[model samples]
Target: MDYNLMREFADSWGLVAMALFFVGAIAFALRPGSRKMADEAAQIPLEDGRS
Candidate 1:
């Protein structure tokens, strides 16, 4: 419950955790064969009830 301890964690581990998440997200988005899935998702709203 100490403020200093929490701040130190946020300044260190929290920063590194967020950076890794950012890198993973960027890599996933840029990977091969993603465009096809993205295009399908984009058309979801326009599709009829028939599957």
Candidate 2:
């Protein structure tokens, strides 16, 4: 295996990949379905009378 090639590739593309992943995560988190799911999860205990 070539360590130099691996390091260069990682340095070049790793940041882009990480940035894209972060943006995607943020977008998904702000989506309506995500909020709805969160709201439903918050109501579970209330519905079950466990609160």
Candidate 3:
């Protein structure tokens, strides 16, 4: 419950960890063959329950 301690952690290792996670997420989203999955997801609402 100490604001100062939390702030210090976030200013160092926490920041690095979050940055790495963001980069990894970006890499995964941009990987090859992702477009087809993204397009299918984008069409879900228009399927009209035709499944």
Candidate 4:
């Protein structure tokens, strides 16, 4: 089934692509306004005091 070839390909570009995706996700999660938006959304129900 050519396991060696598959492993080599995965180790080459697959690893790089995974690392890039992780970095992009982290950057997006840490971006500005993300936390502020979350905080505002959380306060909406609280201001109304209604579950």
TM-score per candidate, chains pooled: 0.87, 0.68, 0.82, 0.66
Candidate 4: give the clashing pairs: none
Residue-by-residue lDDT tens digits, candidate 2, 20-39: 99999999889877888989
Ranking by TM-score: 1, 3, 2, 4
Q: Candidate 4's C-alpha lDDT?
A: 0.91
Clashing pairs in 2: none
Candidate 2 overall Cα lDDT vs. reference?
Answer: 0.88
> How does residue 16 of candidate 3 score in lDDT?
100
Worst lDDT 10-window in candidate 4: 42-51
Q: lDDT tens string, model 3, 2-30?
A: 99999999999999999999999999999
Best by lDDT: 1
TM-score, model 3 to reference: 0.82
| True lDDT of residue 44, candidate 1 | 91
Per-candidate clashes, comma-separated: 0, 0, 0, 0
Can you write out model 4's per-residue Cα lDDT over 1-51, one digit (the tens) per residue?
Answer: 499999999999999999999999999978998999878888987696655
Candidate 2, number of clashes: 0
Report the candidate with higher lDDT, 2 versus 3.
3
Give candidate 4 misplaced runs (Cα > 4 Å).
40-51
The window of 10 residues in a row where model 3 has the poorest summed lDDT is: 42-51
Better of 3 and 4 by TM-score: 3
